[model samples]
Target: MIAVRISIVLLLLATLFGSSLYWLIGQFPGFVVISLGTTALQFTLWTGVLAVLALWLLFRILLSLIRALVLPGLHLSRNWQAKKQHKNSQLTYRGLLDLAEGRWASACKLLTKTAAGSELALINYLGAAGAAAELGNEEEVNQLLALAEKADSRNELAVALTRVRLLVGKGDYEEALPMLELLHGRHPTHPYILSLLERSYRNLQQWDQLEKLLADLRANKVLGDEALRQLEISIRAQQLTALAKNLGPDMASNKQALVDLWGRTAKSLRSVPVLIAHHAALLSQLGEPVQAEKELRRAITKGWDKELLTSYGLLGGELAAQQLKTAETWFKAQPDNPDLLLALARLCQRGELWGKARDYLEAALELDSRSEIYAELAEVMGRLGEHDKSLQFYRQGLLAVTGGETQLMVRA
Candidate 1:
């Protein structure tokens, strides 16, 4: 409308000025009638042409201004869309992190709402499965893992591990074994996978496979020197037990195998007190009770472990009484050792050295008044025909118990 109005104003002014000039020309003596009419006609035609052109220019300017206003909105919309997509991507990433950190429900919600089958989505799904497993949402875990597997076959490790853990948790070792075999055969060097597989094999009592895999892991440096040595010792112990079970008490092959295992294990596993005790027990079982006795004594010198102390006396079999004499001598050197003192008290009670047992047990109780020590003392006192003292010690032992002590309490 403005363009039209401006065009009319321009056309009217051009006509008025041109007409006035034509009249002024006529008033001059030399103006011809035809010439003036032609000039006026030409002026009117040029004015209308200029008016259309001016209207077009005005319209173009308005159109350019309108585009300038609308163009920014278009760019802003695009930018907003890009930012929204980015935010969604970030939310997906955060969900994956949450899943890794065990936020199951948050992970599930994020993954379920985000784009599926993309690499990020697949990762999110995997994380959700793990989180779901932690949350005990077994059905959701299975579903998520399955979805993740469907999205990408490269997710085999994640899916398989989830399945293996679930099976292991359920004590379905038979089902878990096949998956472990597959993983071990395929990705034999994956530390995490191999670690889980080794545990599964150990649980199944598949010593031969466990030993072989443990050797591979050790060679690859997947397990540290200490861990590898410990695992090797465990494998040897398991093998020894299997051989001893199959070949019976007097089998020469069984005895020889046990001796060879113990001899090597003693050197490799010297740092691990538990494994050292195991090797000592194997030595004793293989008919080398004195050697086993020396190993336990050596271990005690290196480390103070109460479990090993208990196992040392139990490992000596028929030579237990003689081993106790040696243990007593060792205890004299480390007289204040609470575990040694306790072990001596038990040994003396077993040997029925009543006065010596009472003295040793009383000494142990004085050092550390554990319920077990009190309980043991009470039994020894009762066996020595000291009923009143026994009852009094029993009451004292009961009073010393902390919460959940009933679990540890055993009748002597």
Candidate 2:
């Protein structure tokens, strides 16, 4: 609309100018002369002005023609470059999506193809390296890593972490450890780096290092409450296992190490049933049945754990009698507790009190008909010289074991 208005205004001005020129030329009443190499010409003043205007119009048309001829190639080149860039951007985006979707081969091909053209070459190379790692193409991964390092040498942290992640994913902890340590030195408080380091240490079975790392993570609040609790339990368990390995045939030394570990552990962790059971088992193995019995009783008083109860019943010698007495005390408080009854049955069996074992097993079976209780009753009946009853209990136990699907045993 504006262009149309401007054109109309220009046309009006041209008409006014032409009329004024014609009027001025008539008032002058003069002629102009021009001589060429082989011809001479004379013209009125208006005619000469008209001739000059026509020449200027022709020059403009020729210039327009030249511009029209040259500009298309330049435009085509620019358009091609733009389309190429757009394609490269799309490839990079799709490759990232494919990587997220676990399409390793396709993502590797796309990302590697577009790496050179991608504006963020560092990111492209790193992503391609991850895909290559997923495909187990170690050589391609190294090449891409080198390219990423060259693309931006200052991004050492990102490149190193990428390498560490790939190595860890491939279960190459030995290779990942040094890279993680390097990152740890530079970014001591980075949660992701610390997490990776923790995993690497765990996979390498470097329990001592993991212990220290876990402490740091806890201090920094990198691990949440429940996660920290679980990690602490796992770290302590691994440490105990390591200590057991290094006990060197000395039962007393092994027992003392475990006792010291238990004493040093936080009370919250000590209250965990699994840890308690573990400590008790270690103590029992080291010939400290009394101490094992005490540990189990303390833990059970705090919380009733079936596994702990089972472990409690497994304590032998004079402690068996004492544990049985302790367990029986709980029977009044928990008269129908199947775990308590099972523990009592186990204690009776260990003490060779066949009658009491049979009674406790039957009572437990009445409360909770577990296959284990049936099997225990069968064993007790066999020990009591009741073969027919033993066979009957054994078949019942087998039926329970198979979820009553099929009875494979024959009748005695």
Candidate 3:
């Protein structure tokens, strides 16, 4: 209705303007002349105005036709691009969800599909690599990792670290170390690089390299306090054990190497219960019985470790009598400690006191019936001429070995 009213008003204005123009024409009676190359045309003033209005209306129609032909294609192109991008985004989301949910095969398929068209092609390829690894497809994993690296050269560290993690998870430590070492060289302070290098070195049993890397790990705060503490103990203990393996038959030279190697480490490391136990075992292995006994005795005096006390009993060389006396002294303090009782039994065995050893083994078994305790008691019974009882205890120990831990806890 509004359009109809506007059209009626326009028609009335045109009619009034036409009447004014006619009056003006009667007053002026002028002519308009147009030249086109070799032709000439002539028009009155009203005719010239009408011709100009016709040309303008023809131009508007042409312009409308052009726009009507072009705009929809442009809109369709833009709409297609938007829809394609949205589809890619949804696929990326689903692919990552599958990876998180441990659907290895589905994630591998989705993450790799249409990845070349994805904006996050690197993420797609890397995620596919992880899933492929879980699916035990090593060839596919390598291919995906290579594509991830090619997609983002600037993120080579991320790609390399991902590969290292996969290798380590597969127990491919030998294959992982060279890559980890190279990456570690370039990105010395990167936390993840340090962590991966640490894992690779640990799995490879490269304790010396790990020992050297530890200071950096601590300085960079790569590992938490408890983890670092436990790791340090393991490294130090393994270092001592490795040192014992490399020693020659010469006892004096072995003793010197042991002292020098252990002495170079920090006093705090020396005080670790496991390290001290390892060092004592090394000294015993190298025939430094006096030093071995002293180390165990000193650690025990400073603090009470069931393991250290146990080691003390096992290291009875020429000092078997005194070591047994010391363990018996501690028995008064920790009367119910099974480890201490085990230590006392071992010390008695070293002294060849079969009756006493039998009594201690029986007492230790009553506290905690470990498989080793059963075996030891069985041996003691054999030495004491109780063949039937020895056979029964030995049978129980064998069953514990074949079955669960609690199997030995019940008397056979």
Candidate 4:
């Protein structure tokens, strides 16, 4: 439109200037008004030519001025955009501060007013989601998160974090499971995403998913010794729980399903001790006590655990007897391991080896005195006809119980 306007003006100027020059020349064409004896027609013709050239040059100068004028207009437009963006940024910043201060209503208003193209818009979505979460408006939170997810997916760092958080917040662990798996499959050492995925799966009781994520973390050295130890303990607890829950009398029907699930979980865990224990525990529960015994023994040889003793005792018969022997050996190997001593005490009491059981129970109490252990020991002593010792143990157990119950009440 501007080009057309300029072109039309240039054409009009050329026509008017040419007409004026021609009129000037034609008006005095017959007069001999030459300063150096030049004919009037010659002077008129030269003057007309000069006038035409001058007008053309002048028109060009005007065109140049119009073009030069556009730079300031463009600069002003850019300045306006910058100011608008800065204002939006300020809005978002203030909104975030309000959110931190728990002023959800004010935060939401400020964030909503921010422009979308600014980084403020992204922060606005985050603030709005937080506000919604605080208000317990799940639907509003979901809506805001969905918007955030859509926007962040177009950005590199934001995509994984946003999607995982959204799925987790909604308790959709199964759906949230893939982002890390897909990313780690490509990048192999994305420590942060790996940790998030692992935690999400763990919370959902998806041991198989958790196992795979942990394997990646371990492979990348993202987990330190202490963290790895804690992870192993948690995994062990979960596997044992799964085995105990899934045990059924109809082995022929449920055995394969149990084996497949446990195996898959163990395989994904990079063959951890907990998975081995899980497989054994499941097999034992399924009536293959022999295989379960072997698995437990292997786990014991690799590391010590109280779970093996409890599980072995639950197996009963020769396996249970063998477990007792293993427990005793484990106790002897690591005498300071109070749980091992406790397991030995429990196994001995089951086997009617009353004297050895009493000895181990006392040793366990010495290591770490707890109400449950003392209670069990007192019961065993009463059975052995040592009424006096049993009463003493019972009084100690009562004190421990009182303290424990008090602590629990305080926590509650």
Give candidates' CA RMSD values in order: 11.6, 8.9, 5.9, 11.7
What lDDT does each candidate get? 0.74, 0.85, 0.87, 0.70
Q: Candidate 4: global Cα-lDDT?
A: 0.70
Candidate 2's C-alpha runs over 4 A off are 1-80, 241-246, 369-375, 386-412
User: Candidate 1, residues 1-412: lDDT per residue as tens digits?
Assistant: 9999999999999999999977865665342222564474334444555677999999999999999999999999999988877877888887787776777788778866664634476677776776677778889878888887887787678778777877787677888888878887888777777777777888888988886686678766777887777677778767756664666556577777766655655564556676666667667766777788777877776666886787674674566577678787888688897778888877776677878877877777667778878888788879988887788778777877853332222225
Question: What TM-score, over all chains together, does every model reach?
Answer: 0.62, 0.72, 0.79, 0.58
Candidate 4 clashes between residue pairs 3 or more apart in a chain or in different chains: none
- Tens digit of lDDT per residue, candidate 4, span 1-412? 9999999999999999999977976785642344555534344556666677999999999999998999889999999999988777777888889889999878866775672665645556767776766666777766776676666566545645655665676677777777756766767777777776777778778875666567777887778977976786677558657757866676676787765555454344534555565666667666788877776666665666665555554554455577787766766578887777777777787788888877877777777788867877888888888877777777878888787431111000
* Candidate that would win on TM-score: 3
Give the residue spans of candidate 4 off by over 4 A: 1-109, 116-120, 123-196, 210-240, 248-280, 288-315, 318-341, 353-360, 381-412
How would you encode candidate 2's per-residue C-alpha lDDT over 100-177 as one tens digit per residue? 999999898988899898889999899999999988899999999999999999998889889889889889999889
Descending-lDDT candidate ranking: 3, 2, 1, 4
Candidate 4 residue 370 Cα shift, in angstroms, is 1.9
Which sequence of candidate numbers ranks them by TM-score, best first? 3, 2, 1, 4
Instruction: Say what the RMSD of model 4 is.
Output: 11.7
The residue pairs that clash in candidate 1, if any, are none
Between prediction 1 and prediction 3, which has the larger lDDT?
Answer: 3
